[model samples]
Target chain A: MSDAPGVLTHAAVMTGRSLRISRRNLDAMITAMMLPIMLMLIFVYFFGGAIETGTAYDSYVMYVVPGVLLLCAGFGSATTAVAVSEDMKGGIIDRLRSLDVGGAPVLAGHVVASTVRNLVSTTLVFGVALLIGFRPAASLGGWLAVAGVLLAYIVALSWISAAIGLLARTPEAAGGFTFFMSFLPYPSSAFVPVDSMPGWLHGFADHQPITPAIEALRGLLLAQPVGNAPWIALAWAAGILAVAIGLSGVLFRIRTA
Target chain B: MPETMIEAHGLTKSYGKPSDPVRVLDGLGLQVPRGEVFALLGPNGAGKTTTVRILATLTTADSGTARVAGFDVVADRHRVRRAISLTGQFAAVDATQTGEENLRMTARLTGLSRSHAKHRAAELLERFGLTEAARRQVRTYSGGMRRRLDLAAGLVGSPEPGVFFLDEPTTGLDPRSRRELWQVVRDLADGGATVLLTTQYLEEADRLADHIAVLNGGRAVAEGSPETLKARFPGHRLDLVLTGREAYLRLAARAVHHSPGTLTLGLPTDGTAAHARALLDEIDPHRTDVERFSVHSASLDDVFLALTGETAEEAAGETTGETTEPTEEPTHV
Candidate 1:
């Protein structure tokens, strides 16, 4: 299952540290979880019934489900940005640099931790959405497919967040990047129909990366027609992931250099 | 090459904002023999931290070569990192994690087995006298305790004898903790670990390090045992006082001439007490009641001042003097 005991061992150790940190920061995790939960509740109970859709009101919640899950991917970057920035401010990263540990492994641990956190937060959001009125017409196989897409987005976004964190000089700056990322989906097809957006807004909404990502997610969950949007979404996410990973590597090399 | 634990030949560095380039370490050279605590002393911005960073492979030198534990800092960085550990001046402990948890995390990161990490954390917790605070979050730890935990964290999974780079290990420590940390450093050295450190506290270097290097303007101005450098600088500046004005003028002629009102005769000596005897031979001790015959020889502070051309005392009040390493330095290792 594993090629190198060293890599896995290091990853496991980092995972433990990551999890311990996550556990102690339960309040923070809970606070982050609450944002999506509140959005889910507000959209489903109050706005869900009033909003007009050719689709059923209960079904809109399910339609928005994958988009919200995609939103969780943004948190991976958010968490990393805040944590690494704080560590940098406090001189922890400098100390880590002095240690014998590989810089890549240490950074990888943070990214992995961010992915894990996003997944956990996304799961919580999902559980709450289900309670509010989100039902997928797809089979269990389809549900796993939905999850796989969401995980990819999270991994991709987490690296982006790490890059932001590395580039920022302060924790606030790192955290601030998340606010922009979180807002990206709202203007796209995450919460509302791209067709409902204004003519100019619709053009932007339709073409934005989050738009295709939500469309791909929607198709997977609702047993809707799987089209090229999924391919485009995958390409966008992968491209972003590649850029972030490359930039992170460059930054690490620059620092070590 | 007597197992050169740390060897730097003409190391240099420059840093600033991306737009502006400011040189920090310039053609600096140092060697740390195995199992010795080598101390680097300089004023603020003397490039102590920069030198340590280059040696530790945290930053590359602009030119020259460095090796830690016989591994090149550039080509064999990973190997160099594997053979060394560093405890920076600040505690650098994870505030969210408990003391034991921090150690465990470090152990895990360093490739200890799960059970071994747990065991190592437990052992280090006890050894650092942190078992009592094992469960408490690091934010609640006192400065000394937190630094101890940081050192323990650096030691986790580093069971082999290694080089430990300590940057200003004890700057803010109280007398008791300072003494305790000195003992800890002594133990580390005795146990066959090479330690290279930088400090503004000269007395700490005097007591702890076998070799001391004083950095000035990004260069090693003086490098030797503390005693050797001290012996070279104005080791003995004597004060000769006279009973009468006539006698005072007579002695002050031989000493550095001051005003007639000055009772104290400034005597520059080679720090040898023989100069005191020679000066006393000329002046009749019976004829003149010498109020102050105190001898001011070269101290570590004098060496720091003469070599760096800035007083060490000025390092604390203002950041102006130099960018070497003259500031808060509490690094209890």
Candidate 2:
């Protein structure tokens, strides 16, 4: 037989497979894209007036848009867990492994697809926020930084979800395992300010990774001082990316074994 | 290449708690020559799947060694993998993708160029009678169609004769589908690919395999050609179907074998009409208790029963004490 395919080629082909599956799952795609948008509208129109931000911004959409973007990542990445879990539960994993395909390519495919799905929904959320009178005063550099930070977070979260998918026994259980990730944003700076939350809640809201990520996005978009929030956000993303990638490798071996 | 396309020796694997492990494979050994179809016949939890998995490089045996296509399964796994295709018990095709897509993706993963993969996919789809359903999602296909597609997927990268592992390839298929798959398997071996298949059906092994291994308690109790195995239980037998259950019970002591389900009693004979008549007369002189009687030679079923001390059907209905391989969960289809 001809030389076996390289790892990169396998990853690319698997990525194509994942993307095709994502495209055909219209119900899931629509839910992933629309959930953040619906949440954005509810906060901006329904809950925006009742809540007050300590910032100088006039419209609540400006402060809430970044948090919704992070929410979009959470919801989009959870699908990665279900997709990976489905592959593991089926006979396809054994088929692929028998064909000489390694776990890295198979898991990478899901993470990359998750990132692409999150990006689309993030852009859609941004557009909907703009339509609802949200305006940003950031320069080009700030926009690039925001994109970099969001991409890092989305990719990192997707890997974490992939690891969870490997750990779970079924697709439903994998989806359930990701619930805490989707809810992380809510307890952080996604909605109201940390100070506005109860005293006991401030510890988690201030110290968690989601709060720094949202803080970095809010500061960048509003042209305010971000201090070390962007670096902290990127560090969190990098740390999670490392841990998740390593954990996914271990989990993949364990599950497949 | 070695004449033996697949070989395993003293293979052992166990699962469960460390203190109380359940041995799935205990000193199992197999040798399949080139271009031959070898069948591992056993009931559930007989370690047939485990043996195939070890040889296919999906799972490693806890002890011993296996070589597939002249490469060690554990050390040279990539080489072994490149030289083998495994069609697992479950149909492994992606439900969301079309049949064509599933085949093409497998082709791509196996190192085919994009155009070549497409051409190969279409060729296999046509060959497997799935061309009409090529573009339809696999989720919409019937079980038989899915199995054909799954088999087609495994063949995508195999242009040359190589080791092929089919784990219960026709387990849940209808009779027609099973026969069709048998022909396909025969064609595969006829074309020079060494095939190692596992099955619970004695007839499947008898009909298809050049050599059959009867596995029980994680070891092969008997191994030979169908005819050779049948020769072990040589001689014809008079099979008598009694008129009533009471009559069957009355003559049950005189019979060599009796089946409660059919009220049939089997009495050994010398394959002579006179001997068959004499035995029948001695058992039921008036012929009022006898429904019918027929003289038949021993079959693989009889050989299996003789070797394992249990009818194949009975063995299938219950789990053996030494085997605890977890039953596969039902696929979502």
Candidate 3:
């Protein structure tokens, strides 16, 4: 009999499979990338001038783009919950598990593909933001740092969505659970400054991971003082990733057991 | 003497709380010889799926040990997975992927090289008679095609000298598709693969399996060759064609099946000439109690009902075609 395939080989094969699946479902891809662009347009044209940003709508677009990009990545990552839930419901999961393949590759395929998908949507939104008069004042290193932070945030949130997907009993339930994370940015530093929020909401907005992530992105892209937001954001992303990976492992075992 | 390829000892499984657990398998055991098809025959809630799942290494049993293809299901799970293929009640093929892609992915996952995997996928598509539609997504495939694709996918890991677990593989197919799948299953067994088929139809077990095990209430209530199991019950059955509904109603106490459409009452009996005469004499006191009667030998349907205390009508209803037993001694009344 043939020996079990290596983890990297399994991951590659499964990642190829996931990518093909995503390619086939172009509507989902468009929806993921377009939702953020739509939100950016609405907020910039309708609500940007009223917000107390102390800048013109053109400059406000730049300020809001980071928050919108974070929201885009978070929302895009949540879409993976539907795919993962469907995988759990389908017979293919059991079929693959029955094979002599490493367990990590299955989840790895979804996580990696999800990260890629989020990055694509984030890039599309960034492009759209630029088309609408958004500009950045950061150096090349700052742009790289921004890219690094965005990638880290996407990976961490994708894992969390994957965990929620595995834990949910149905695809609808998974969608419902993961969709709530998109709103997390609204209460944080994504849409408005934490200090400008109402008293009760300010505490949560100031401390949550999304706030630090938004602050880091703002600092990186707008040439603002980042202070310790970059470090805090990295720590939060790492912490969530660890917990999500651990939770997903436990959930897989229980569901399969 | 054939060596055993699959062996399970005292397998037990349960779900829910320890204090108020629901037992699905209780001290169940199975043994199958190499290169033979053994069918686990049972109705719903009979632990057939549970046994298959445990032996396939998809689910673990609470107490027992199961070995498939000479490897322990628990300790050597990887080896067992490598040596076995399971096609569950659901087709399990990716609906969004084309049939060819599905097969190729399975092949690659089974450690076949890229070129080998492609070759294997093409071969399987041709073998399953889906080469024309291999490129189309499986969502467009008919039920039979999907099942064939599923069976093809199961063989990606290889079938020769491998163990196959088919759990109710033909549960919802039409007669034509069901017959075609039965032929495929027979082909698998003839190719030297040890096949463990779980099905609810008695005729499926009788036609496809060399040995049959009747599972009930979390255990094998009876296990033997089809002929041996059939021999355990009464030899013959008395079929009485009634004249009217009233006649069938009167004979309902002694009838195992009362079909209003055919106006026939099936009664269990010994195949002896004397028993036939005695039974007819006892029922003929009313003069018009029965219309016509004939005696025929018992089939596996009778065996399953007798062994598991289940109704034969349920089994007969599930079957697509009639199972005709030979007449040992023709006696009419």
What CA RMSD would you report for each candidate? 5.8, 5.6, 5.9
Candidate 1 local lDDT, B16-65, one digit each (tens):
77689898988999989898889998767889988888887878888999
Off by over 4 Å in 1: A1-5, A44-50, A55-63, A87-91, A94-99, B17-20, B233-302, B308-333
Model 3 lDDT tens row, A1-257: 56667989899898888888888888988888888899899988888777776543246787798899998988888878888888888777878888866556888888899898888888889999989998888889899889889999999999999899999999999989987888888998676667787899877888988999998998888888899988899999999999999999899888888
Native-to-model Cα distance after best TM-score fit, residue B241 in candidate 1, in Å:
10
Give the alpha-carbon lDDT of every model: 0.74, 0.88, 0.84
Which stretches of candidate 3 lie above 4 Å from their native place?
A55-58, B232-238, B241-305, B309-333
Of 1 and 2, the candidate ranking higher by TM-score? 2
* Candidate 2 RMSD to the correct structure: 5.6
Cα error, candidate 1, residue B124 (Å): 3.0
Poorly placed runs, candidate 2 (over 4 Å):
B232-255, B259-264, B267-289, B292-305, B310-333
Across A110-187, the per-residue lDDT of candidate 1 in tens digits comes to: 788888888888888888877877777776876776777777788888878878777787889889977888788889
Using DockQ as the yardstick, the better of models 2 and 3 is 2
Q: Which docking band does candidate 1 fall into?
A: acceptable
